[model samples]
Target: MPPTHLRRALAVSATAAALTVPLLGAAPAEPAARVASAAPVVPVVPAVPVVPADVVDDYYADAEGLTGEPLKQALHEIISTDVTTLTYSQVWDALKVTDRDPADPDSVILLYTGLSRDADANGGNVGQWNREHVWPQSHGDFGTSPGPGTDLHHLRPSDVQVNSDRGNKDFDEGGTESPRAPGNYTDADSWEPRDEVKGDIARMALYMAVRWEGGDGFADLEVNDSTGNGSVPYLGRLSTLLDWHAQDPPSAAEEARNATVFEDFQGNRNPFVDHPEWVEEIW
Candidate 1:
């Protein structure tokens, strides 16, 4: 799902339906055995288990009084180091943490469709779910590389058709409600994810921009005011992202996702997801 890759064109009926209002398309279930990720096969945890008081307190404590680009820089220095690297191929396993089914740990939830697929149903199998690059791979031309390619924070399980429907479009206001996924919408050049995940997506983008700061030849991913960042590795619109960060805020689901990523897969937390006010602090 990195920025530059073009999703395969949608089939005619799927396209028309996706471009229409409030489509409640049902996701086909996938077999459980096909999943290859090593994540736990346990049942889903409660939506909001209590987070330990000190688990992430020091993660951003040093940035407490900083603001603007300096704040962004300090936070980046804090989280970007000592990260556990997963191969892009292993994102399947990581999804079990970042995108798991809240009610079923044996499954992963598709972002746009809100459908649960067997965790093994990952990758590009037709009708099966696949890793979606919130920051499209093509724009930065960084495919399957450790930082952008395999970063669990930015990758998510998405319905194949709905992911295809999004097709590298920028996130913005206004568009037809997705026929394939409720709460999601698309139009000429933008995407509107369902309200529940809006803040989740915003925080993910902000996290990517901060975590992969081009220090080690990785793209200095950034969020801007526009879209179609080409080979630039940037996602937009920043103003819209800022608004969504505030408007939707972080839900219990977002908190749980961050906790799982830290306690299980990535080892480093998405600061914004863990602390929403960071968005206001740095931007």
Candidate 2:
């Protein structure tokens, strides 16, 4: 993680760590908040085969025909158990699959910017990239380590500058024009990712809230419509996120990434990406 000083200026909440999710539109600004690639390099990213349908079915069998909060809860219980945890270091390698270029399997794409860079730079610093905690680490006092800190479902490869700009801003509509990344906008309270990853951001946050289940040292992550440098373990503007999820839908990048993660990286699946209908079913 960037040095503690670089972390967004956050007050010691009841929990002491930083509050994640930007809250500029309606909530007050924190007294000073803060804050991929790709190519056909012949299998640039370690290709992860798709998880078998039967395997995925067996994995979510407990929630069959389930819907609403029960389905949500059941899914939480199901996905929360038997997950293979990876170290924060392993995340760097995992991104190669989760964020690969949709157009070219040989390369990985950066989130937000949607720029396709060389896959050879996976670990090399040729093009600067950092692991972006979509849920924002401090929200639950989770640092850059194992467990929630390293979960591949929510972590993504981001341009270093764009990542910093996003900070821990909550998700919402309306913002000053973003100069840093086209299609990106920021205001006093929140940051809007480019259209490309709108559904992506939504799905990741939703997945975390579902997967963590408030157990196993995982913060019971929540999604809401509130804003600000929230100290609680939740993200906001659920209504907007829902809209984004619907408008953008899942793309080839997301499908491939989900399969790769389940088959290779974490041995689990992002239910929302695997089954977008679950968003409405649960919410």
Candidate 3:
């Protein structure tokens, strides 16, 4: 979480944190962010295998079937629940991939410098940096407005250019192939999801999908296109590339941003990043 100053800015609802989806054509100025590769140090825990597409459908089906406050409560439970023996802010911060000031709200810099030491043995990988949406603040999600506790899906750290290119557009098979889409919505220029980041995206999508599965029309943000079509079925349809992205993991800058955001707002760390083994389902 950020320091007091940044938190204050969030309270006013004027900063980016206060808005949900960006307006039409609204995109961050930078394009594909860079990511550096140091040594491929193996994870301490066993790798959480990506769920097969068919299995992913099972999870989706189960999540989709849920409705009403039951879905919302489940989602809130996921996001609001504190990881075992960890505070919410601590878990949230662990997943950040960007560098940010504990006190600044606009400094969500997704690149790494010589100063980063959290993820790398030799300080940090200065090359692996990318802009991560604190909340997959999709510009396409209608009626999005950052306020007290808004739905934050579509969040992930990726090449800045790729994310920029995807600005506010839904992941649809628009002749262009997008790695960001699930099998249903493929675009040529869509995000080519990394292994680690895919899972991260999945987690966010799952949270939203389950939460809004039963919301009223326009209120549903979770499951989308019940039949695996392109349109978001409800307000919380999970993004397709979540599993692949999570496997690839967010850049160091994104991890940092997650940390700062949690510290500033929810006051928790990102448990998934810190303890990758806890993840069971990733598509």
Candidate 4:
């Protein structure tokens, strides 16, 4: 009934509609379905949040224009202000979160071995992970109490045997390679962590030195130049630790861990982690 040109147009329109119908209604190809099913699902880790500039500014407001022991004392006052101390038992749960593997939520990354193990696999067993006091509790004699003993800033998850092997040794440069933790070296007097975490270890030690200044009934912690500092509330070789701090700057994970301690857990930030330049300025 239509004109010839109109009929041709209608036919073309109908052909397009017909072609679209199959594409719209059809299931995906069997090959595609099978390929998708065979593919592994990658887990997603939430990105670490950056600490706001104003927050850092305000936190260190009282510490401005200061250097050397005065700077150290000011920072000590700043970090020690209104801190929330966790019990030693609560630290178990805290490390599981703070040191959680970015690639796997259910696992934690060990400090020395760098192994990612199941979060619940924390204990004294040979294959498990346990709390590593980066600042040895024995050095300060603050064993398992809520203050310096349980501070999360210096606490980390570590392989059980590796933690034991690292036991209270002052950090220094060289030794035989640690048995299970490659890249780490240990001798009778000192233990050097793998290069990657050397700055992390140093900053934690610095933080302890600044945070606990012989007040609050806790021993005054310090970083000196000697090793074999048995139960003296001091950690050393300072010059070596300073080198480690310079050699390996703060990593993103370390910064994020610092933020987590400040924002979520400890209500205080590690000044060395935030302002690494402060290390050279002070020591």
Q: Ten residues in a row with the worst lDDT in model 3?
A: 20-29
- lDDT order of candidates, best first? 4, 1, 2, 3
Task: Give the Cα lDDT of each candidate.
Answer: 0.68, 0.67, 0.33, 0.75
Q: Please, what are the lDDT tens digits per residue for candidate 2 over residues 1-283?
A: 0112111212223221111111101111212222312221121222442445677778878888988989998888777666677787767656654565534544556676656555455543435777888888877777876788888778877767778888888898888766546677888768888766788789999998888777776678888887675677878788899999998887644666666565555667788887899899988
lDDT of 1 at 256: 63
Better of 3 and 4 by lDDT: 4
**By TM-score: ranked, best first:** 4, 1, 2, 3
Instruction: Give one digit per residue, the lDDT tens place, for model 1 in 1-283.
Output: 0111111111113322222111112233333654444222222333335346575677668777888898898888877766767787667766754565544555676777666678777667677888888888875778887777888777888878888999888888888988666567788878988765677788888998898888778667888899766677778889999998898776655666666555545567788977788798788
Candidate 4, residues 162-213, lDDT tens digits: the string is 8999999999989998767777899998999876678888999999999999
Quantify how close model 2 is to the true structure by its C-alpha RMSD in Å.
12.2
Better of 1 and 3 by lDDT: 1
lDDT of 4: 0.75
- Top-lDDT candidate index: 4
**Candidate number with the higher lDDT (1 or 4):** 4
Per model, state how many residue pairs clash. 19, 16, 86, 0
- Candidate 2 TM-score versus the reference: 0.77
